[model samples]
Target: MKTDSRWITTPITADLLRGALDLERTEHGVLPHRLPARARAQCGDPQLAMVESQPSGVRLVFRTRATAVELDTLPTKRLYVGAPARPDGVYDLLVDGTLAGQGSVSGGTVQVVDMSTGSMELRPGPVGTLRFTGLPGRDKTVEIWLPHNETTELAELRTDAPLTVAPDPGRKVWLHHGSSISHGSDAASPTAIWPALAAALAGVELVNLGLGGSALLDPFTARAVRDTPADLISLKLGINVVNADLMRLRAFGPAVHGFLDTVREGHPTTPLLVVSPILCPMHEDTPGPTAMDLSALGAGRITFVATGDPAERASGKLTLNVVRDELSRIVAQRAAEDPHLHYLDGRALYGEADAAELPLPDGLHPDAATHRRIGERFAELAFADDGAFAGSGGERRAGGR
Candidate 1:
């Protein structure tokens, strides 16, 4: 057997990972989780369990002079039967704080779930390798951001030279929570997720708690955010609640209050931003327990349609318009006493005009281009001078001006 004598392999451990709250060592490798063990134990929903384990803002960071790097991963890919196949998850390689390369590993196991029948099937596949060669010859910091939509198990890291853990950049950490939009739905790559993009634009570290179909105002999630250390915090509320039909007006207002209260208990003076949902034409005036359009699915496309009646709003059902109004009022009332608490109408990021030009392809989540637009807009609105989170110990450029 021909053996390469110059390769050095390092076991991926918690020390090499950032933006992850916990790591679970598995038989094959280490799995990074966004939620701590205690918080994970409090939830019994399988959906939540799955999503919390999907690394959204997690990255493997180290310093090396290696010209070649290889990462072995075992990823659990999801597939929905009778629907369009999803794209392969992408891994982004950043060298010296610049995006240097992008790659994807194939051959991971697939979990096919039939949403109509509620049955799932597991199809085992081989592990795959992601390799990037011809990096700069000098010592430099390297960050490998994992896929946001897939559950990745990091098995081994191999390089041509010795590696050391990268020193923290001392940037302010921004912890954010939202639904699938924040979870990178339709995003092109791991770093393209809106929160990641916004974090880059804002020059802050991101800790994203964006669970798909699972942001139900759960106490554990609020507690998770409460316990995490952060210089800036933002919560994108309302869309998930409205779409999931998780609660009525009566419970939503109080639940929001409780969530904020819990966060405030841990961070009384921290800069906290509360954002409502963007304009979703389907659910703007109508309440929803959003359902799939079967006809569209049969036509080889997927579409979501609001099922609840608009008249239900009169009986206290929640809608996007209702949620936005209520959220604005709540933040305004509290901001008088809490100077650091701030609010941004989500429409400022994406409104009816933007929707007309660039519609949500699925009638819910924004596409990749929209993600870019939102990220850029957020940086301007929330991270600029005199903005809600501006100069709150976050990174700034030049001249103290």
Candidate 2:
């Protein structure tokens, strides 16, 4: 804790947060969670537990006249045992809804995972501070977007001026769910993630439920989405399912239906969009159980390779193409009775041509440039005049310019 008398310390609370469904009071401070406690209690998956705590679209929003601000955070960074070190997660500061500055914290806890053996080891580290100074002193809305890929615990918030929770701008809330790509894998920062970028471009409040390696249409996740308040909803399905090889085609269809049913229970007429997987050559026609490219491991690079047999499609195996076909058919069939239900072929956002231009460096997640491209494309497609999310009363351009 800083002893500077000029700094005003404010206790972090739920009213200062956006995009997180729940907040867990930690030993140091509150930790934001994308999923509620009831949903977390149902699943014992370690992957879900970690990713949901990563605060994809979560941020601290308030109105203040502060010219200087400091946030104390304890971040848990993930590392693959033999792979190259991951970069430090970034914190983006926005003033009056426009990006103003960016900073990062250092010396936090580390979690090292051995991909081949599925083993994880933790290393303790100290908390770090992120500070921004010399802002315009006039009263303005300020947002501190946390890292999308790092599990962070908020310790304290201090500013040179008094701060109050910002009133809601009354934007329609968009609740989205998907895999790691949507969870912000390989993106530059929190606000640079595709969902965040798209929400900014489309002018809506984002509630990201994009769990990495865990968007397998789990009932608990569906229930969480069902309970959250939202005017628009989207599910980016299939990649995690195919890569995890969690189920067969027989189970995939029913799982998709069940997930939608759960969400519709609470939001029956909400414009719901079902998005199929984008083009990943490794899993496009080939079934997965994607594996680490062990050969690259020696070079300290991490890449993925599909291990499932292409012949397994005969046994009801699910592939990207298979999932896309199934999703289109399912959405069309359901749309007859539910006019608000919509389907988007994920390739529209990133097709083979785009993949050829900006290949997935990991054979899975998109690069930062690709993330920007996807976000821009998604906004155009989903928020356009004739798009499914259009005319939902919250489709303004970036900064409402």
Candidate 3:
């Protein structure tokens, strides 16, 4: 019955949400005034796609019917939005027509925390719209974050500020792929996601394809990478495929080539880096498809754990070493003809030594702090030379450090 309690949808989609723009209405459906090439083809699931970047002005518009009363003080109960960059994450609250609020966002120092501590608190990230929770009676100014994906940028305006957001100008587009860790499982903020932080450090942009619970070398994802535009690209592989038992030695070889082949079509010759998995004890050396960890979620707990044998991991069945070895072979053979391809031992960024100090907080994803460390290492290794990859080979990549 109320604006906040209801929402309307139109048929419009794009690859990756990019740039800033105004919303437009079309006979076919609602369309964004402008969409970047890369963002034009992301997230095949249109069910939850944003109308545009920030919903193409109103991508995920939500409001509340709660009568206005001035916020005598900060509200206690709050909302949380995790994986802000992920398309399926549709958890934004808008007030009036402007973006009055946002989900919890993290900066370089702060971690996104929800009132529950384990969750992220959704609140105003930028100030294009105004959210009226209990503020109907007062003539007061409420603070709002800029409507667009803003970080390291700042400005201030009253609720009357025109609803125009400057597109992210520090765009350095880094395309990253990996397991849950890369999907931002434990990172502190939406923007603080490792790829994002690394991009920030290098003054580049990002196109993160880190799929949670599903980075098992899906061909569609490979095509996604092939079609997307990126200044830099990195694929953090291994753990997921090994744990998922997605492929065996015979099939894995060709699959890797196919994935690369698809990417090469679009990238042609970008700074492509292949990264192996970090340390995980359970599946380290085991050949899976393993089980899930569903102990705490009511009845579904037991089914989550993988049933694969641990011996396989300890012996030859499963191991980061095996994955790394084969992966190296793949890259080596590929590099013979292509000079731009590079490889980095996942550990070097956060190898065994660092892992010892920073054990996996969740047995998989790194903690917020580790994400920061990883981001820095990636920047150093990625940009340490003349824009080339800083790998164990000690060879400078085509791009400068």
Candidate 4:
């Protein structure tokens, strides 16, 4: 590609970012984080640490007449030591709210994990550039949705024309937190994640806090939600808790209460939706500490199995079914005092029949097709004309201060 002498390079700063909670300056450039530093410091869980920095819903928003743009990034890609290979994460470019192009960058550092051995190793690599050309000639708003699954470090940004911060979409912002299912673990790209898809369909802004393996009803996470501005909120609970066996039925209800109470402090009347876990037969009735199916991994495939016994449920161990029932009951009890609060069975988004049609490929996360299905189903059930979250778009506010 030929560079024009008039091309300009702009420093990528927070002013040009959206949907991110924090940005950390680095030697290479800047790294986006879904969790702020204070909230991140409150947790020591490695899984939480990793996912919060992955930027699941973060993007760069700006306006320019540039017909060509380039972003230098160093992506930290993950690789399971014994599992099959995965492709590079994709970068999606949207012009005037429409997807104009998509591409992926390679040659990034690799974080290799050997689940069998419970060990991790880092392999350093070089940075790569992602380039998009043929953008419209006139100035237009642009959104560069980051990869949902990769940890990316933005090094620099270049364009053929001067750039300025784009105005906000002037829509309601929906803040959602969930497990890997909502993190686009299996989705094709960042914008394809269920929350992103649902937000776009409902014509609202999104602040996805869908940390993979980390939506454990933590107080700090609750506080983060409380501080953030949102017109609507949703919590997709149960899967991570059940799989990790983090808490039993004895403590689950109170945790849920505490989480909701904190958020209510910030947005008492926001349309809050409590969503239970989607269908996962492995942990449906059986308790879990979901274990990797090593036999499957050895065959160049990956799968999971519930390791907890059904008998444990009688001991107050929480299974998906138990959690779902509890969540429904809790919502009903609270709705008496807070009519704005509502509940939706995760199964409604991906129930038994839907699972039968598109079985979970890994017996855990939904596949790409299922991501699309869930996104569409969620939009229909929650954002439709008569839905619980109907008319929930954040009231339009004046653009710019």
Which candidate leads the pack in lDDT?
Answer: 2
lDDT of 2 at 162: 98
Runs in model 4 deviating more than 4 A are 1-4, 393-401
Mind giving the per-residue lDDT tens digits that candidate 4 earns over 26-51? 87899999888999898888788889
Candidate 3 lDDT, 111-195, residue by residue in tens: 2433223444334332122233443432322222222222211111122111223233433556677766676665655545576
Off by over 4 Å in 2: 393-401
Number of backbone collisions per candidate, in order?
0, 0, 67, 1
Instruction: Write down the TM-score for model 2.
Output: 0.97
Badly placed stretches (over 4 Å) of model 3 are 1-159, 165-171, 294-307, 310-318, 386-401
Q: Write the per-residue lDDT of candidate 1 for residues 164-231, one digit (tens) a residue.
A: 98877777788898988988888999899999999998888888988888777888888888888888
Which candidate number has the best TM-score?
2
Point out the higher-scoring one by TM-score: 2 or 4.
Answer: 2
lDDT of each candidate versus the true structure = 0.88, 0.92, 0.51, 0.90
Candidate 1 residue pairs in clash (backbone atoms < 3 Å): none
Residue-level lDDT of model 2, residues 158-216, one tens digit each, is 99999998987878888899999999999999999999999999988898999999999
